[model samples]
Target chain A: AQSVTQLDSQVPVFEEAPVELRCNYSSSVSVYLFWYVQYPNQGLQLLLKYLSGSTLVESINGFEAEFNKSQTSFHLRKPSVHISDTAEYFCAVTRGGADGLTFGKGTHLIIQP
Target chain B: NAGVTQTPKFRILKIGQSMTLQCTQDMNHNYMYWYRQDPGMGLKLIYYSVGAGITDKGEVPNGYNVSRSTTEDFPLRLELAAPSQTSVYFCASSYLESTGELFFGEGSRLTVL
Candidate 1:
């Protein structure tokens, strides 16, 4: 069985400040990692994914997540956040088959002006 | 493209009531999935289908039933609604089972009273 853990349930950061949302996973086999974002009253959208290429993956919206196999972690990071960046972020993992993604509890990123 | 569309954006059900949530995808993807999102919790997979008529249970499938009669349609049925089932449900589709990105619908909010 695979499971994901997000250390922070809520992260409050000032606008224009850097932020990191921590995520860790436990899986017996190799896995693909992903970060998803959900805004208020909306479905989740993929932020970035690490399939089999480089350990670091970036999203078009300036968010990036690094897959660290040794640490069993994939943490999402943003150099600077904006008011529009306020949303809930989730970390997910899936093995190399037809299995569905296992998601963490999620971290609410609240940007303060 | 509409990508994925879920009907009844918002619904309210009473105890012991039954209803079905309809989902369709315009992209003609072979893989479709159903997930539920609870407050402070990330999405949990309810059921998934590989193709028309090939459906399987996912992480959370206790109170739900699903049918995939066509490549584009996958509807989830709730036998008896309960307060625990009150959450936002999302329908998603992907081209591949493992590595492809998932396109999700706006989501259907269900409130059971």
Candidate 2:
């Protein structure tokens, strides 16, 4: 069985400050990684994904996550955050041939203005 | 296109009541999924369908039932609502299962009293 772990339950950062949300996964087979963001009262949106090729995947909204196979980690990062960036972020994993994804307990990124 | 759409954005039910959450995708995606989000729990897959008439249980499917009669519709049914089932329900769809990005609906918030 595959499982995901988000190390931080909450990440508080000041506006314009760098932020990182840690995630780790355990899977017996090769997996694809993804980062999803959810705003208040909304559904989750795909922030970024690591399917193949580049280990570092980026979203258009200045968010990026690196997939480190050796460490079983795919941490999301942003150079600077805005008040609008305050949301819940989730890390998910799906192994080869799987039909569904396994998600971690999300990290609430609170951007302090 | 309305990538994914879920009806009844919010609902309140008494214990032992039954209801169905309707989901539809106009993108003609072959894969559809149901997930529930709770505080700090990110999202847990409740059920998934690879295509019409092909449904499977996901990580958390104990109290839910689903049917995929058509490619565009996948509805989740709760036999007997419970307080534990009070959460935000999300419906998503993707073109493929192996490595496809998911498009999600806004979500349905359900409160069981």
Candidate 3:
């Protein structure tokens, strides 16, 4: 069984400020990690993913996450955020052959103007 | 691009009532999944299908049933609605396994009273 833990339930940051959402996972086997973002009244969209190779993965929108195997963490970070970045972010994990991803409790990113 | 589509964007069901949430994908992906999202609880997988005619249970499949009759359609049925089942349901698909990115539907919000 695999599990994901997102320590922050909510994170508030002013416009142009940097933000980091912490995520950690526990799995007996090698796992793939992903970050998904959901805007108000919309479905989730893939932000980025860490499947293999380089430890750092980035999304087109300027968000990036690093896969740290030693620490079992994949934390999302953005140097600066905008009002449009306010949304619920979820961290998920899956073993390569699993049926579905195991998601974290989610972290609501609240960006202030 | 009409990616994944989920019907009944919002529905209200009385206790003991039954309803089916429809999902369709135009991407021709071999893997489809159903997940429910609760506030502060992220998303929990209910069921998944590897391809047409093959289905399996996920983390939370007790109160729900699913059928994948074709590559494009995977419908989830709630036999007897309950307040505990009040949440937003999302349908997603991926060409490969979790190693690939997932495309999601806009989601269907269901409320049971």
The DockQ leader among the candidates is 3
Local accuracy of candidate 3 as per-residue lDDT tens digits, A16-97? 9999999999999888999999999999998999998999999999999999999999999999999999999999998866
Could you arrange the candidates by lDDT from highest to lowest? 3, 1, 2
Candidate 2 residue pairs in clash (backbone atoms < 3 Å): none
Candidate 1 Cα errors over 4 Å, as ranges: B97-100
DockQ value for model 1: 0.69
For model 2, the local distance difference test gives: 0.90
Please give, for residues B1-113, the per-residue lDDT of candidate 3 as tens digits. 79999999999999999999999999889999999999999999999998999999998999899999899999999998999999999999998644647889999999999
**What DockQ does predicted model 3 obtain?**
0.74
Q: Is model 2 an incorrect, acceptable, medium or high docking prediction? A: medium
lDDT of 3 at A53: 96
| Superposition-based RMSD of candidate 1 using all C-alpha atoms, in angstroms | 1.1
Total backbone collisions for each predicted model: 0, 0, 0
Name the candidate that leads on lDDT.
Answer: 3
**Docking quality class, candidate 1:** medium
Task: Name the better of 1 and 2 by TM-score.
Answer: 1
lDDT of each: 0.91, 0.90, 0.93
